[model samples]
Target: MSRTIRALAIVLGLTMLVAGCGSSSGDSASSSASSDGKFTVGFIYVGPKDDFGYNQAAYEASVAMEKAVPGVKVLQAENVPETAESEATMQNMIDKGAKVIFATSYGHYEFAKNMAEKNPGVTFVHQGGLKGDTKLDNLGTYFGTVYEPVYLAGIAAGSVTKSDKLGYVYAFPIPQTLANINAFTLGAQSVKPGIKVITIATGSWCDPSVQSQSVKTLLDQDVDVITQHQDCTKTIIEATEAAGAYSIGYHADASSLAPKGWVTGSEWNWTPLYTDIVKTVKDGTFKGSKYDGDFRVGLQTGDNPFVQSKYGSMVTDDTKALIEKAKKSFEDGGSPFAGPVEDQDGKVIYAKGKQPTYAEVETMKFFVKGVVGKIG
Candidate 1:
């Protein structure tokens, strides 16, 4: 879930928080991370901020956090790599005056952990991970159950696919991506029995050239619907649209980008959670609060930062009803992985009447029966 950045710099967004997801962080006015009695919050993304995908969602929420929490200024660095450079960038933020750092990439957790130990004053929260090294209260991880909405989108994809071939272009077989793929396969199978999901794992998250080739590979296989788990998602979605294949979006609302092909999606709504976390930090209550450890949210938890996108015109009323009913099951303690689920080899993974817990699902390793891809 990371990619290379062409131009990397810590651009301080001191802009007054504006309305909508198209938030203009005031001006490109650069300043110290914190000045004029402002509490500074730092965020780093592995891709460009306006990529219409993952970074954009986080960027928008960062601006909202600044506005929602009083006396806060947001400092963001786009196209940050998952290398030692990430650590240095964070250290630079700390050197300036960042009190809270949102390491918003899976690859940044280790680096964030190291920095958390060194700078106990600055609280570090990693995205999509658990609290592994919890000796210090300064380091924690948090994420919404993103796979939940992906399953709903899969239902839409399954309903719309004429060829019964759904393609998935993913970055890597990380557990998070694996959970999304498996949930999507399971959701599709629930409605369209025998629907096959052809998968192409492009090792890079935002390599446009590789993504184009992967899209070509999936389309060549006669796939009628496409979805992905890459960092920068515009290329694959646009390519699929041009090829006349239905596209299920992820990470952000890209329905506008694929007007003809858009069929619902899973995207982050991090404003609520980001605001809550930043508020706690501003009040000096984050140390021993619920945000001090691994915090997971979903429909069952009253709110999930990841929610289903708007339904496309191709989605039928019956399919929307199915999605609503399926989502209700989750809210009622049912799961997308409620078994009898089978692995690729038809091995019974979860028995009937049983399902993996939220935490257990995070450690997912194998593809489900309908996924036409290898785990390694």
Candidate 2:
């Protein structure tokens, strides 16, 4: 589709563009963010900036990049749902002279992909979404080895879990979340044999009422520790703490909210990567740049952009040592889902001495052997 045609569709859809600090108001005044002038970058989020979860981390990174790059401006629109509204937001930013756009939600990929095709002059990068067969120069996906820290947190969960049952409250059965749940389960199993993890899918990234009910169900099942792959996590963590269960977090730290039941969690530090992308785009090097494809950083890459939080008081020094040892191994090129891994049906998945590549891991479709849930 042509850019002009797409713009007309957006206008007819009556989609609204949020105007904020550093934002545009649908006026066609020439953009300072043009390639030759003051570069402007746009970021659209799927939730409130202060959710203290996924969006918060991305929002903070956007602000950091804005400051890191001198003479560059940033446009931010929060609370952007994953629907066609996202397409409108992209068009608005493009009109405002944004040469690079960060679509910071998984569900935003389709719209971002469409926009990337329509606007070859602009660069679009997405977070946590897999790159499809369309090999566009201006489109890419980037993420950290998020499952690495989750595995570390799982070690803590396993160390302290009294009933050998760890509960996972996740957004979906997608490979990324599946990898986290599998890593968490495997990490716990490494510490405590015969450990079992119960999995429940909330299906929505930031639903509180559904998360609260999942916690109650897990608590009733005598699960002692709970962790999640959800976006807005306060409801689940707070619910877990209220029920006297240990909680592990994702996206951002909720340690303050679960003082008594808090375990160490994983968080995003996107400065290095985000800044690098902005610089590349601003320099007109984004087309053939390293960020031009499925860019993933892990321990071996030296900075995964995701790391573990400080350990809770309940974690033992011995457990911390073990986590560090595993981390070192990962830095030396070990994977959480290493060889000898099996599916829930006892069928071998990754045979001994054979490992799954990052590509294989990204398409993960089965529950690990000890997980107690169905993935469809």
Candidate No. with top lDDT: 2
How many clashes in each structure?
Answer: 1, 0
Whole-model alpha-carbon lDDT for candidate 2? 0.87
Superposing every Cα of model 2 onto the true structure, what RMSD results?
6.4
Clashes of 1: 1
- Tell how far residue 308 is off in model 2, in angstroms: 1.0
Off by over 4 Å in 1: 1-30, 33-35
Candidate 1 residue 193 C-alpha distance from true site, Å? 1.8
Cα RMSDs, all models:
7.9, 6.4
TM-score, every prediction: 0.86, 0.87
Mind giving the per-residue lDDT tens digits that candidate 2 earns over 202-272?
A: 98987899999999999888999999888778889889999889999888877999999998999999988
lDDT of each: 0.86, 0.87
Which is the leading candidate under TM-score? Answer: 2
